[model samples]
Target chain A: MRPAGFLVALLLAAFAAAPASAAFQYYVFREFGVAKEFPLEPTRREAEYRTPLLGRAVPATIFETTEDNMVYRFTVADMRAVDLVARSAGLYAECIAMAEAEGKVLARMPQRVEDGTAFRVYGQLTSVDLAEAGGRKQTNCFLNKGWLYKVESIVLPARGEPNAAAALRFSTSLRFRIDQAPDSP
Target chain B: MRRIAFTAAAVFALFAPPLAAQEHEPLEWQEYAYPELGIAKEFPASPQRQTGKYQTEVVGENAVPSVVYFVDFGDLIFQMTVVDLRAPEHVLRAANILAECIFLAESAGLPLANLPLDVKDDTQFGVHGRVVSVDLNYNLGVRQTACLHKDGRLYKMEATMVHPEEEDGEAIARFVTSQRFELRKP
Candidate 1:
């Protein structure tokens, strides 16, 4: 079997046997200036993020993986523009609006992190699942220096508490470098 | 009683004489700096200070401490409010704080125009704020508000003119332009 497929199969087996302890691993991406926990190895790729207010797309890096009908996505976008303080405000509003678009926002909380601002938003997805309770999503977005960090989890309602815990672990694990130089490549 | 008081105040404001009718001299301006609050702004007169709390969506059930320094000149009023948001959830969220202030400022009157502002401060990361001009309800007057967040506090400066004349423009400009943030080093 292919290594990637083999890894997914292994994750599926482990998830079926023990859903709560599904081989989560701590990942530290120094280049991105963030750390988080992932249930499976995430595929990293380059993409462009749209900032509607800014009227343009910016270069971004995306890390994504899926397991047991749950999708996890983490994106780090470099806003290569002047006046990030203004841009960051617009970005925060944009992120919240995007999350609200998925469905009804159940809750939102502002958070202060080292050298930046973070927001946690919980919402129920509009799409319904026949086999599950419903669809849900939680997004944690952080704006530090000129970089925007986004962590998202989409899980079926049936996953319930385990997934909630997993989501919390994934988002809370996110940490940034305190003394790192700003806008370092 | 509250309604009666409000009605009396509204009646007084509605029938109040205009600045030209009163033939009042140009008001004196002075810079009021509160080192403890790390803010300084120009006021037409010595302002009376009041302490209060401001509620917002992100702050949850808890209310944040706020201080307001205001001078009511009958014809024109100048006020400044500083909201301390040093709570764990509100730290570094100056943008959010500014948004709330803007919302409140807009809610007070009908928005006529807005100008985006970049308020300079002592920190490398200054404040991104806005100046909103509004026409107050009940024909009260015109109000111009400038709001920003710096160093964990939201600063809002407002100037309300009962009937601003052409000459009153300079005083309004002076008050708004003279506002600055000089955060004291810890």
Candidate 2:
């Protein structure tokens, strides 16, 4: 087989059987309402929170994968239940109160993607909730057609493979399932 | 084939007078400002800052930390790299920065020509370099690279496009001429 095709096949296999080895793969997530792709199959969890604005139990599905010491996570918070209210600012500020963010956000810029504007923020991601070491996290959060989504990559140098390139690929590959027609996601 | 032409032109550029910018009307331009580097210049479009590492010398052994500002517009790939040349780990660094263009043009299969540059800043040195057309898998492209060095950092800006064929030389010339450098007060 051609080298490119062979590599793709190997990656897909690795992604399917992530527990067995350290190989990374392309994983498409359909568990959530929207489809997202992570580098590996990823462990999945769901959490429901009561919002102060509407007193509604909002649901957010979190998908995460650890490889080469890096952590990749995608959070899909369906705000349709709350009429797509912009409450992310409150959430971000509430978390900051726990521990002043290590430092200011290094950078945040609007990224033009297929659907619309996605804001990407990155810097030394530190939390007062946990003991600090060294590493960083980059997050891209955006609202598309009423749904709010966040794609995050945490660099863990102590873990093993601080594969930053792979971490970025995971975030950049995120889309609201292009197969669905535009404005429908 | 490309190597031979690049070597000869590099030798010729070492002694040649600085290339003069072609006369042309200004095109729409945008400012690319980097406060950290204390330098800013105009580009055809908003540029992206990319940080990476590269070989400090022609030997390709010792790696030098670098940040490259790059963009793609119309038919050209424009790039500017700022390299920290203070010290790598082992291999000796080249004192002259003009040689960087020759090495890069040869590896990319683009024929090169260059000459010493004269600019406003006394602490700065520059080169007016050009690359001829060559097939790059998908298309035939040529390149124009202008290099400058100041303090302990080397700055290089290059624009490459498919078969520029002398017609687009003015655009490349405009880019090289648009270069501006500032000296920070101690």
Candidate 3:
């Protein structure tokens, strides 16, 4: 067999040998103090996040990666100095506005997770040229222990509903490390 | 008397645009696209474009390059200023550029009106932008401004009415809502 064909066969064989969930790897990031599962190691970078009510921009760390035409991103910002309750509404509004910026928001709900308050939003992003050609996005925000965390997944229209399961899995797999809880923020 | 007349003529020349702007017939709306700037919006007429400098807190002390496309209708004014914050020294501050621009506008006006509480609120302006309406101090009328930051550029849009009492509010709303930002193609 040709070298290229042999490589394909090897890849197929590896996939067949492992269970679906076995492909994902779990990692603990001491710096961000969170443990999460990702299909591959996410690229880390420093970015800025906007505060809800104060209209200020604060430093944030972002982890992002793409797999099979789907994008997964996680962001964490320390907001210890700000009042979360007073700014909770702005926080939620900003998240939803971002989703609606590209498309229409399909649904949203406030969910009480294991340790924090999470807001889940579903959006249908429409293409500017072709309205029918659009993608789906899922954004989940968490306010826990004075830290604001956001997990987002985007599946291109080409990937469609086939990658929905993986997107959902990646978005829901973010777990904060309770043991390594840092300062209040 | 001749010196006074000469000064009066100079003053009138300086203010003639606004007075002449009011004499036009009904506005003919048109859509103008600046592909290089990554923005497209509607204007009452073909707006004249000017390049200038704008100072903001994020890029303190020194002013940055800016481009403004605007149309001055005697009774109304539509202006959009695009500030390039990608300079080597100011690039890192791009994320906070919009907040600083909003702060500058807020300082010149009264308190900000209540923003939307719900994300689904339809009252929100273009694509996650912060918008506020300011009542000018000297009867310059109401100026509604929206600031959006994207791709290291700060887009500031303003629709000002010189005679708000006589002008229709729908015209301002239409111009504000007609703005659409073009995504840069990689």
Candidate 1 CAPRI level: incorrect
Name the 10 consecutive residues with the lowest summed lDDT in model 2 chain B: B89-98
Poorest stretch of ten by lDDT in candidate 2 chain A:
A120-129
Please state how well chain A of candidate 2 matches the true chain A, as a TM-score. 0.58
Tens-digit lDDT string for candidate 1 (B58-84): 444678899999988778778888888
Query: Using alpha carbons, what is the TM-score of model 2?
Result: 0.36
Q: Which residue runs does candidate 2 get wrong by more than 4 Å? A: A1-185, B1-27, B56-60, B88-92, B96-100, B110-112, B122-139, B163-167, B183-186
Q: What global local distance difference test value does model 3 have?
A: 0.61
Candidate lDDT scores, in order, read 0.66, 0.52, 0.61
How would you encode candidate 2's per-residue C-alpha lDDT over A1-185 as one tens digit per residue? 69999999999998896544435454544444355656667787897634332245678777788776778887776655322232322232222222234333444322334433121121112222122655666665444333445667777757544445665566566654445533312
Best by DockQ: 1
What is the C-alpha DockQ of each candidate?
0.05, 0.01, 0.02
Interface RMSD of 1: 7.9
Candidate 3, residue A88: the lDDT equals: 34
Candidate 2 residue-wise lDDT, B61-166, digit = tens: 6567889887666566678887776443111222223233333444565334433343444232222222322334344566666655444466676777654546
Best by the lDDT measure: 1
Candidate 1, residue A146: CA error in Å?
A: 11
Quick one: ranking by TM-score, best first? 1, 3, 2
